[model samples]
Target: MFSGAQLSLYPMSDDFVGIITGALSALDPHRDHLRIETDDLSTLIVGPPEILFSAMRDLFVAAARSGTHCVLSATVSRGCPGEPDDPICTPAEGTLPVAPLDERIAKAVAAVKAAPETGQPVACQVSLYPLGVNQHMDEIEGCIAFLKASGVFDRPKNFCTKLSGDAGAVFATLQQAFTRFGAAASHVALDVTVSAHSPTRA
Candidate 1:
């Protein structure tokens, strides 16, 4: 099984260059664990699900810490047939090593916690796809219920759900969704887009 994500970062500030570079730099340490490619549009990262999520957590945190408004949009998938047949696309025999979901979630929560509070909450739109699963709709509905009950979910939209709150809460809610549904399901994909310092700074 192979997992990957294509992500784009948009820092809503005059000093966008620094914010973007800083986030990319944060991913440098994980280069050994993932195959990373950055083009004009977005950055592609391919690796085990755990590593992929970890890298995303770190990258988003670094960008949010900039204190400037920003958005990180991503599409995550696993077992994609369209990808090139490379080592990154093929996992060795036996189960691929994956970090504990709790560990990964904690890291993300920490990053959000450390971000400078702009007194303005952030929002994120998340869409989950449960691939090759029996009763996928049931799972999706369950996850949506969880998000809504969490008080972070803004509303339910077709093909996706919206979340708005402080950065930490927003990220924590997202991690829960991934772990509860994405990780538990036999195969799952996620599309997540997050905006910080939302509603625009007047």
Candidate 2:
């Protein structure tokens, strides 16, 4: 019942890093840059000896291996005050949303930047998020090749082979590339997300 408590842990050792990392990774993909502020998000885990024992033991073993002995505790902002709430952990190193491989990739995405209401092109930068970075290289190459061959774009060597049309075209092309690249590797947790120009009221 740790609803309004902050969950915090004292680092026991490098071994605990895995336990923390694993827990966070298993929970939220956006777990990173935790702090003792309102913005910080963590899972409050508190309970009897058996509840927090196993994970804590893992942390302890990790600390032992790491040659460090630190205490760790995290409280939740909303939950039962007496019992441990679900672990709300954010990873220390989460995946970056931008997966731009090279200058050419950036150029390719920029080339298809979204236009504004004035029907005029606005300068924009595109960021790619490559998931499952270590996967089938050949498949990745194939997707890029297909995009390049299909895009029919030249002159700007930096330009990507993204479908040259509107913002949607570029997005669609990127997805298509991922689908093609993920061949056979069903767990290919890799892909890129291009944030279109942010929408703001005039």
The model with the greatest TM-score is 1
Please give, for residues 1-202, the per-residue lDDT of candidate 1 as tens digits: 6678889989888888888886788788878989888899998998765566667767777888877778889988775555544455444333432354445444444544454333446788898787776777866776676677655779887778888876556665665565456444256678898887655532
Q: Whose lDDT is greatest here?
A: 1
Off by over 4 Å in 2: 1-135, 152-165, 191-202
Model 1 ranges with Cα > 4 A deviation: 83-121, 149-152, 165-169, 172-176, 179-187, 200-202
Judge candidate 1 against the unseen true structure and give its global Cα lDDT, from 0 to 1: 0.69
Question: lDDT tens digits, residues 1-202, model 2?
Answer: 1212234444444565564554443222222312223234544333321223223233323332333444333321222234343343211122212333443344434433431122211111221223344655644554465555434222122423222333334433443333233322232322221221224301
Local lDDT at 48 for model 1: 61
Error (Å) of candidate 1 at residue 68 is 1.9
Residue 146's lDDT in candidate 1: 68
